[model samples]
Target: MEYRKIFYNVSEKDMSFEDVIDRLKTFITADPRSEYVLSVGTDSHVHAKDTKFITAIHLHRKGKGAWGCLQNTFINRQINSIHEKISIETSLSQEVAYHFTSDYLVELSELLIPFSDEGADLTFEIHLDIGRKGVTKDLIQEMTGRVLAMGVEAKIKPDSYTAFGYANRYTR
Candidate 1:
């Protein structure tokens, strides 16, 4: 059931969307001078009976440190189509990014305004599971287009650690 969504990370677990926003705000203020990247991504693994999808929302304070949270979705059936699987993954990432509305961005940006001259900034990204290499190549435009259409940046492959790295780690 997608009714009550919750996100969990190492420092905290079972958090709501508002809670994630609050924690992220705290993380930013904790080191206001650092550049930040807020990313959303999803990855999936198919098992004998089901396909498990893990969506991750990550906040990075440059090279110093980072915090992330993830939520899982399951389909009680194998996802044989690469298109379908990757499509769902992209959708999940979009769902998370959609929560960070223009108002939220303004608030987040205001937090970094003071340190902007020092290179402190905020970037919002939607990480797609599709890439420029391998079978995912064909779907790059379509998937990335979906994300870009939402007025957010999209990253894939070697650059998209959120989907291919963070979320992938938990899909297992």
Candidate 2:
């Protein structure tokens, strides 16, 4: 039920959410520990990749399951719901963020466990890169403020890092 939220930043040229998801899929496939989930929140720029990609991946290794939610949208409504439940908000971009709590993470983990057993450990990851400028820190701060107004824990990170961290391998 305990989950860790890690953030990172990367470049935004010739990169899309799909690229991140593909890398994650490759990572899961190579690892022996099957139970895990990978989620990628992208900007609006990389939304249309003309591919039938999976939105989430489930890694089932042994009896453990890890569920990854590839969220593309982080509107006020979603943030408020997560803040109310978990008190933790993960912002990938000014426009895309996700909130996860112990209970919800546990639920996600449970949902993904079965996939591992059936050799379906990897699920499709979501992309949210919208390819727009002006989604700056101020916007994120505003969003965070709104979440806090609702009595929820919220934070914001640079969109560049969220989109390209995998390729850059920069630690957040």
* Winning model by TM-score: 1
lDDT of 1 by residue, 78-122 (tens): 999999999999998888787785447778878874544666889
Model 2 lDDT at residue 21 = 40
Q: Cα RMSD to native, each candidate?
A: 2.2, 13.6
Clashing pairs in 1: none
What is the number of backbone collisions in each predicted candidate, taken in the order shown? Answer: 0, 24
Best model number under lDDT: 1
**Candidate 2 per-residue C-alpha lDDT over 95-115 given as tens digits, one digit per residue, 9 for 90 to 100:** 222333312333334443343
Which portions of model 1 show Cα errors greater than 4 Å?
Answer: 1-3, 116-118
User: Residue 36 error for model 2, in Å?
Assistant: 7.0
